[model samples]
Structure formats: C-alpha cells, structure tokens
Target: MKEIMKDLKELMMKIDKFNSQQLNMLVEHIFDISNEDDILHLIH
Candidate 1:
C-alpha cells in the first residue's frame, strides 16, 4: 500500500508538470481505462 501511495504521488507530480496537450491525453486515457469504482470516486 505504501508503494502504491508512493507511486501515485510520483505520478501526480509528473501529471502536474504536464502541459495542456499531455494532460488532455492523460485525462482521455484515464477515462478510457477507469473502472466503476474509479469513475465513482471521480464523480462523487
């Protein structure tokens, strides 16, 4: 779990550094791959 958290933190920092184009693609990919729980968390 700590590893997951660490990786996710790294991912978020990387995401934060993305310019508009990369962030757009990332958002698109996230939507494409997200499961029900993931979608629920986002919306809620």
Candidate 2:
C-alpha cells in the first residue's frame, strides 16, 4: 500500500509538470482505473 501510494504521488507530480491537455488526459486515465484510496491519497 505504501509503495502504491509512493508511485501514485510520483506519477501525479509528473502529471503536474505536464501541459494542460496532457495533464487532463493523464488524470482522466488515472481515474478510469484507479480505486478511491489511490485517487484520494494522491490528491491529499
């Protein structure tokens, strides 16, 4: 769980550095498959 959270955080930070459209797509894709905890942990 911790490893997953760490990876998710890293992915989100990378996504943050993207241009708007790319970031939107990345987030959309992430939400499409991710569980509630994964998304919540990333956001918080």
Candidate 3:
C-alpha cells in the first residue's frame, strides 16, 4: 500500500514536471475512463 502510494507520488511528480496542458488533459481523460480497480492493478 505504501509502495503503491509512493509510486503514485513519483508518477504524479513526473507528470507535473511536464507542465503541458494537453498532456494533463490526456491524463485526466484516462483517469476519467479508468475504474479504481484498474488503477490499483496498474500500480501493483
């Protein structure tokens, strides 16, 4: 759980570093399409 949180934090930092609105919107769309279980499986 902690590892997953850590990984997610790292991923968010990387994403934020992009500083691109298009990329952010794409990521947001992906999240909107994904269910929680899908995300959990991805992190694992």
By lDDT, the best candidate is 2
For model 3, residues 19-43, the per-residue Cα lDDT tens digits are 6876777668769865888766655
> In model 2, what are the clashing residue pairs, if there are any?
none
Per-candidate Cα lDDT values, in order, are 0.80, 0.83, 0.79
TM-score against native, each model: 0.42, 0.42, 0.42
Tens digits of per-residue lDDT for model 2, 1-44: 99999999999987777767787887897789658887777778
Against the true structure, candidate 2 reaches a TM-score of 0.42
On the 0 to 100 scale, the lDDT of residue 40 in model 2 is 76
lDDT of 1 at 12: 89
What's the C-alpha lDDT at position 17 in model 3?
79
Lowest-lDDT window of 10 residues in candidate 3? 34-43
Looking at model 3, the pairs that clash are none
Off by over 4 Å in 1: 20-44
Q: Which ten residues in a row have the lowest lDDT in candidate 2?
A: 33-42
Q: Could you tell me the lDDT of residue 32 within candidate 2?
A: 90
1-44: candidate 1 lDDT, tens digit per residue: 99999999999887787767787886787789659788667657
